[model samples]
Target: MSSPVAMIPYTNMAPYRQLGAPRDCRFVPVVPRVSIGALLSGEVVAAAVPVGGLKALEGVVETVGRFGIAAEGECMSVLFFSCVPFEEMHFPRTIRVTGESASSVRLLYLLLGSIHGFNRLPHIAADGRVFDGELLIGDRALVKGQATAGEERHFITDLSQKWFDIHRLPFVFARWVVRKDAPGPIKSAISDWLDEFKAREASLVEQAVPEAARTLNLPPAAIRRYFQVIRRSLGERDVLGQQLFIRQFEERGRSLLFQPAP
Candidate 1:
C-alpha cells in the first residue's frame, strides 16, 4: 500500500520539518489552494488548509488535531499595503488581492465589509500596477514590509492585527485537517506529530529562524518576532475567536461556512 500523504505549506513548513517528517508518511509541500485540491482528490490524506476554503470541506474533512496557524495581534505575513490610510479610503477603491492564500483574501473582505463597513465592497484590481491597495501574504508580504517606493511609503495594515483590534481574539488562518474516512493509524500518527511539535515548539522555531530569515531576506530578530505572533495551538480562546469571526462573517450575508466535521 502507498504511504499516506500529508500536505504542508511550502514557505511555512520549516517548523514542521524541524519536528522531523513523519517516517511512515510522505510530505507534500504546496500552497493552501493546492493543498485543498489534493485533499479533495484524496491525493493527500491530510493537509493544513486555509480557513476560507474550509467552508467547502465542511462534511468532507475532519480536524486532525488542534494544530493550526493563528495570530494573536500581528501576523507579519498577511498585510494590506495601501497608498492612503484605510480609514480615509472610500468605496470602489481598487485593491489587488494576492494570488497566494484564499483565507487571507476572504479575511480581507470580511474585515473591510463587516468591521470597516464598506457595504459596496472595493473593486478587486486585476493589475497590481493600477491598484490603490494590495493584499499580500506569506514571504512576499514579509519582504515587502511597508511596500515603499523611493520616498513614498504605503499605509500598512496587518490583517491579524486589525482582527484583534476589533475582536480582541486570535485570528486563525489555517488548520490541520484529514479526510473523514482516513485510517485510524494515520489520524493517530498526525495527533502524535502535533503533540511532539507542541512539546518542542520553541526549539523548532529557533531552528527554523535562520532559514526563514534567509528565505524571506529578513533579519533573524525580525523573523523571531514574526514567529512570536503566530499561535500554534487551538486552545479555548482561539476557538472562541474563530467562532466569533464566523458569526460576524455570516452576519454579513455570507453563506454558512466551516463546521468542523466529526
Candidate 2:
C-alpha cells in the first residue's frame, strides 16, 4: 500500500524536519495556500492548513491533532508595516498583503474591520509599491521587517500582539487537518506523528533554529527568537482564543469563510 501523504508548509517545517520525517507517511513541503487546496482536492490526506482557511474546508476536513502554530503575543513573522501609524490609518482602507498565508489575510481583516472600525472591507493592493500599509507573513515578513527598521516612515504592527491586547489569548495560525472520512490507518499514523513530535519538542526547537535561519535567510539568533515567540502546542487558552476568533469573525458577517470541524 502507498504511504499516506501529508502536506506541510515550508515555514512550519523546521520542527518537523528536526524530528525527522515520519516513517509511515510521505511528507510534502508546500505553502499554506497550496496545502489547503491539496487537502480539499484529495491530493493529500492531511495538511497543515492556516486557521483562516479552515472556514473554507467546512464539512470536508477536521483537525487531527492539538499541535499547531500559534503565538502568545507579538508573533514576529505575521506583521503589518505601514507608512502611517496604526491608529492614523483610517482614510484609505486598502492595503497590500503578501500573497502567502490565508490565515494572515483573515487576521488582518478581523483587526481592521472590528478593532479599527473600518466601514468597508479593506482593498487588497495587487501591486506592493502602491500601498501605504502592507501585510506580510512567514519568512518574508521577518526579512522585510528587518529591512523596514531603518526606514523612518515604516511602522511595524505585530498582529498577534494586537489580538492579545484586546482578547488576552493566543492566536493560532495553522493546524493539522485531514479529510473527515479518512481511513483509520491514516488517522492513526497522524496521531503517532504528533505524539513523536511532542516527545522531542525541545530538541525540535534547538535544531530548527539553524535550518529555519537558512530557509528564511535570517540570522540563526533571529530565528531562535522567532521560535521562542511561537507556541507549537495548543493549550486550553489557545483553544479559547481560536473560538473567540471564530465567534468574532462570524459576528462581523464573515463567518461564511470557515466551518468548525466536528
TM-score against native, each model: 0.89, 0.88
Note the residue pairs that clash in candidate 1: none
User: 1-262, model 2: which lDDT tens digit per residue?
Assistant: 5454555555545777776555567777777877778888887778778887788899989887788888989888889988887776554545776667777877877887665574544455554347668788877788888777768878999999999997899999888877888787778877788888888888888888886788778888887787788887789998998888878766774533222111
Candidate 2: segments with Cα more than 4 A from true spot: 4-6, 120-122, 126-129, 254-262
Candidate 1 lDDT tens digits, 30-70: 77767777788888888888876787788889986677989
User: On a 0 to 100 scale, what is the lDDT of residue 44 in model 2?
Assistant: 78
Model 2 TM-score relative to the real fold? 0.88
Q: What local lDDT does model 1 show for residue 118? A: 47
